[model samples]
Target: MNRRSLIKAAGKAGAGALAVTALGGAMARAASTEPRAASAKPRIHVGSDPGIGRWSHAKSTSHEAGWTDQFQGMCTDGTYWYAVSNEGDNQRLHKLTLDFSSTVASLSAPRGSDHIGAPTFDPQRRQIYVPIEGPEPELIWKVSTGLSTVGIVPLAGRTPGSPAPQRWKCPWIALNPSDGLVYSSVFGDPERNDLDKYVDRVWAYDRDTGLLKKEIRLPSKVYAVQGGTFGNGGRNLYLASDYEEAGNERKHVYAYDFSAARDGSAVRSWGKVAIPDADDEVECVVFAHLTWRNARDTHITVGILDDGVFSGSTDNVYFRHLAVPSPGLI
Candidate 1:
């Protein structure tokens, strides 16, 4: 069976039966099937401002059958939201209302584009920035907020003195308004499963010239960065790992001190919290001031593209609404 079908079968086989404790902790499972020591009790991180804010299971919403595809990244423009997905026949950039009540529009990725990352909105220009895995040198596309393609710019550089062949896929992006620089997470060797070969390296680029400004190697533990967004009024940066399976290590959303990373320092690992759902893989995370209309109340929301438990059903996008303390955003 194809991977999606297998995923459905895995869910029906008991994945859906997995439940969260009242405290939002998922039952721990071993990363491999071979017998091993008893897994330690899962650590439940709590508190309003414990680095990564304490998260609670809010709710989940499913997508339609035709919408069954890989969800990569997401972002909102206060008034509307955009999510990027690719694979199968569902490759497109989706535009939705803030509440996901409806899809306002959709745009097919440029021909030759293989994958698209979560989109970043350029409020000053009224456009959305989307990165893609494509052609010889990958490119970032500038699409109008209305979901129309405006133009594309070739990503102009790579990590220096690396022995690995240059193969680029820009899967996450954030526009730091404080300095007009674009930070992106790039992956190498798309076909390799060895995590180290394709691990993520974040780069800051001059928005006006698209020239590489600085790059920092992420900690070796961050296997891949699925999506990211600016937080703390654009002072801090957050990156999310796309999901690993239940038996594997926990998926995390990590926060970083932006200024340090920009100054050629190691991307300091600030704080992180495990996403609550054990069965699903979190495709990406987008934080926006979606509640209370206050900067302090910005909430973190993640898109689960592959977690499902029901039988005879195709998995749709499942959004887990997370509640982080308002004081934490500041």
Candidate 2:
């Protein structure tokens, strides 16, 4: 089926529900074992925190003109922005203007991988770290700013004592400049009763070698994390969750203190901002300093893929530029 018909069919079934259905099988098999009770309750609460400041929407731009496949993750290098789209045999990585007004260039997904997830940019190495989901033993591809594949890091079979041999499914990745490590985790379902069992910790990899460095356990689990990036000058890690509970009209972007996690201290959410879109699927989040035309400022941008399947609209994608009092200026 073509894009339009596929979207129409998906719409009738419900876009969010369709995504869960399409991705659910892999997630279930990826779980090492059945959910069991935790030894102790997490220190942090499951819901939003009041201390976190709210992000106000500043502006948005559509990608309808230069439409790719379903938008996945996005990041920036203080100047241009980079994004990825996954369409199973036709995935792509896109370079865009700071405002996301137009696509500057595009590259086909590296050979051997079809589904590309959230991506992070490394300024020192000048490469974009992209998460690849399928064809088993998920991998992370390092592509240069010029859009050429530089290196490939296989994630599976690296961690010791991991129950399953092929469980690493990279849905998103983020780079921490301070420690020079890239972070990623297996996707989880927020609505599942045993959500904590699946997404209890995040794996950090050596930035250059892609070797398994360490696993940082969270004080609380954040389910269905579609995207992640380091914000506040690499002091905090921000995550975006796409799963919206039944009858709930909002999803959330969560924040965690990176320094505290490194110190092995009790880390809780600094705050969360609710994205009020019920129809569109939230894909990824990135913090960057952007300057376009006469406007110059910083933003905590979230990528919202138009689920024409749910919204009954054309295939489109856009980024919502959100503002906070202080964004740590990238």
Candidate 3:
């Protein structure tokens, strides 16, 4: 059976029931098979400013069909939003309306590439930068707005004089319009001993040639980074983490200042924004200029994969729109 059929069958087989619990001020949903410990709490590292401010729960939309299940990451072209999903051998990219009210188009993963992660849009090229993992070496694929593959940038072996082939499991990527560079981070726990020493650093690549430009060392160890986007005229990078443990809630979006690192100064104090849903896995975050009620406004959009409702008939993907004082233009 296909992935969607399998999800539906599993849902019918009682995988949809979720146990809800209140932990502190947030809520947690425990699956029927695996229960969470009552003592579990999210790990919070809120900077003094916490720049994003309180995210107002705006609106959420769920996709139940075959092509759009298990959303991994998302980006916007100012007018429309593009999302990527991976299901076993089936990986697809979907185009949706700005509000995510409906799907406009869907395309399968490019040949020879399997798992697709978060994607970013390039306004100059009018293309989407998709992070594809597997098929030996990972790649950053440049795709057209119509969902067609236009170019490919091999991520491995880009680091000069590397002792071995660098296998960067790029789960998320973002575009810096000001400098015309694409940024990506290694997936999973960067602090883990088994991971490469450089995994903790964010890699920036030239947009046109795809050559390794430079690596930015993070001020702190960020674990399980799933998605990231640029804001404040590409001066600040916002990253989302999906690290969750029995006693630690690592589902947070962090912001780092790029300008602070340029002058050999301390990378400035970081900012943090917590994802309210304790049960859902945080996916991707993007900044978009959206039109609501014929009014244009900028918003910080976050994608959450609601595992808590996987077994139920409800939609599993939640597109959360957050209101920030000034999201800054890209």
- What is the TM-score of candidate 1? 0.71
| 136 Cα displacement, candidate 1 (Å) | 2.3
For candidate 2, the clash count comes to 1
**Per-residue C-alpha lDDT of model 2 across residues 1-330, encoded as one tens digit per residue:** 222233234321101101100000110000121212223222332232323355666555556644335767676664456777665466788887644557888888877664577788776687888877555556778888888888887764354433222254566777776677787776665433442224667777765555677667776766666778775435567777776644555677777766656523455667677765524777777665333332323256677776454443445776665656543322
Which ranges in model 3 have alpha carbons more than 4 Å from their true place?
Answer: 1-50, 53-63, 156-166, 190-192, 196-199, 245-250, 263-266, 290-298, 307-315
RMSD values, in order shown: 11.8, 12.2, 11.5
lDDT by residue (129-229, candidate 1, tens digit) is 88765454556688887888888876665443322122354656777655666776543223344432354466777555566777766664554456677
Q: Can you write out model 3's per-residue Cα lDDT over 62-152, one digit (the tens) per residue?
A: 4554434666777766455677767656677888764455778888888766457788878778888887765445677788999888888
CA shift of 329, model 1, Å: 3.2
By summed lDDT, the worst window of 10 consecutive residues in model 3 runs over: 12-21
Which runs of model 1 end up more than 4 angstroms from their true locations?
1-50, 53-56, 65-68, 158-166, 187-200, 243-248, 292-298, 307-314, 327-330
Best first by TM-score, ranked:
2, 3, 1
User: Higher-TM-score candidate among 1 and 2?
Assistant: 2
Lowest lDDT 10-residue stretch of candidate 2? 20-29
Q: Model 1: which ten-residue window has the lowest total lDDT?
A: 12-21
Per-model TM-score, in order, reads 0.71, 0.74, 0.73
Deviation (Å) of 51 in candidate 2: 6.1
In candidate 2, which residue ranges exceed 4 Å CA deviation?
A: 1-51, 99-102, 156-166, 190-198, 245-248, 263-266, 291-298, 309-314
